[model samples]
Target: MLKKLLIACLLLSLIIAGGLVWSYQQVKSSLDLPVQTPENVLITVKSGTSFRGLLNHLAEEKIIRPSTWTRWIPRLEPELVRLKTGTYQITPVMTLRDVLALIASGREHQFAITLIEGDRFIDWQTQLTQAPYLKHASKTMSEAEIAKAIGASGIEKLEGYLLPETYHYTAGTSDIELMRRAYQAMMSLLDEAWQTRDQNIPLKSPYEALIMASIIEKETAVDDERGVVSSVFMNRLNKGMRLQTDPTVIYGLGESYDGNIRKRDLRTPTPYNTYTIFGLPPTPIAMPSKASVLAAVKPAESSYYYFVADGKGGHKFSKTLTEHNRAVRDYLRTLSK
Candidate 1:
């Protein structure tokens, strides 16, 4: 009887060992086997999705087999259960373990939108509306309404408020949210620049600095010339002279501007007409980059009071009207050639 009992115990232990080996093999095979598909597939995991629901969805799409093993593996591994909510691209050659690891790692698909320096507010609106990935909350809203939605209430205009940069976002990001981020970024930078501004600068407030920066942004594309251009404006402002900047006149002409700034356009009366006005424009004409903003508050120490395009993507600085007229003549001669 004792010998028969011992044999029974040995047979039971052998059966348990065999079952363990079979389970291990099955798990390994499931992880190593790739899904049967001809092309890559995009899987959108919505927020608040349960782990079981995600597994069921994968099984329904035939990316993985709907077996007890697949269902139990995630339940057994605590690290593989949680998933992030976003759009994920899955390839046909990826194994079940690869797909699970990819989703669990939370590396979701990213889309980008760029806000260009010197772009008008209307241009920003058009680009935001055309972006397919962003949720269009402000599509039909007016600029004022959009400003209010982004916590910038009572703003008469939206120009020059947004910081120019490339923003990355996922599928559910809203236009309003992007606008808010841009506004905050500009405000933060503007505040820092304003606090560190030069002593007794012409700019009285951060908004005035922003206005000057916008003009500087539109005036020159040369990165190193921004400080010199800013110095010209600062000198003019200190002497209580008219800005006489052509871009401000062009902005004032609005739709009536035919890509040319005639003498009559400069003489015309408008709030943005710095040619006739004695100070900065009431609002910014375009988005100003951080560099331009910094140049506005910290202009170079120079006596320059005027600048004109040198026909080489740069400008020639002058301290007197006679010198400026010569630079203007040189510019016209090149243009006529």
Candidate 2:
């Protein structure tokens, strides 16, 4: 009777071992098998998510077969709690392990954009509102409302609020957050420049310097000559002369001035018009870059008081209005030719 019982127990143990081996093989096969083809699915693994939850979510999406999991646990027990947060592009045939690896690598997608300094508040709205990743978009809010949402107070316009930089935004960012990031970037630049300002420069405050910088930025895109142009404007400001900037005149027109700037528009009277205003415009004409801001704070030492477009993507600097007129005439003659 004892011998018979021992044999029965031994046979039962052998059967269990064989079953466990088969189960292990099945699980491994399931995890290593080719995924279903031709389907590209984007899955988001939320922060603080577990590996099992990811697997279940994948199963629900039908990206991976449910049988893969059912067959997986008995033999090849995987640690289903180690997946990380991220946005992943999952192909149909990827193994569960491949998905985990991708997510663990944190391969979240990004949106690329370039924000140039000295761009106006309206320009920022145009760019951000059109971006797919930025949300909470509207067409009706005035510049002030938008500025307020971005956390700048008493803002006449968005001229100085938006920072210029190459930005990479994650998917589904709110407009307010995007604005906050840009605003923060601008502030950081401002703080750094303010600390290192040239002490003897003629400027009342950082804000005033920023305002001048905006004017300089709007005047020309030739980066190498920004300092020279800024010096000319600074001279005009110190001498109490009219800014005579076409951009401020154009800005004063608001929505009426189409893509063209007519002669009549220059003579029009508006509060923001620098051609008529004796000093700086009430607000900046565009977003000012750090370089332009620094240039305004410490304008290049010169006696230049006037400038006219040289018609070659730059301007000709002059110490007298007579010289400026001559330069303009020369440019017009060249254009006529």
Task: Return the top candidate by TM-score.
Answer: 1
For candidate 1, the TM-score is 0.83
> lDDT of each prediction vs. the true structure?
0.88, 0.75
Native-referenced Cα lDDT, model 2? 0.75
User: Which ranges in model 1 have alpha carbons more than 4 Å from their true place?
Assistant: 1-20, 32-42, 47-72, 75-78, 89-95, 105-107
Count residue pairs with overlapping backbones in model 2: 5
Task: Please give the lDDT score at residue 196 for candidate 1.
Answer: 95
> Candidate 1 has which clashing residue pairs, if any?
none
User: Candidate 2, 8: how far from true, in Å?
Assistant: 10
- Clashes per candidate, residues 3 or more apart or on different chains: 0, 5
Give the Å shift of residue 236 in candidate 2: 1.0
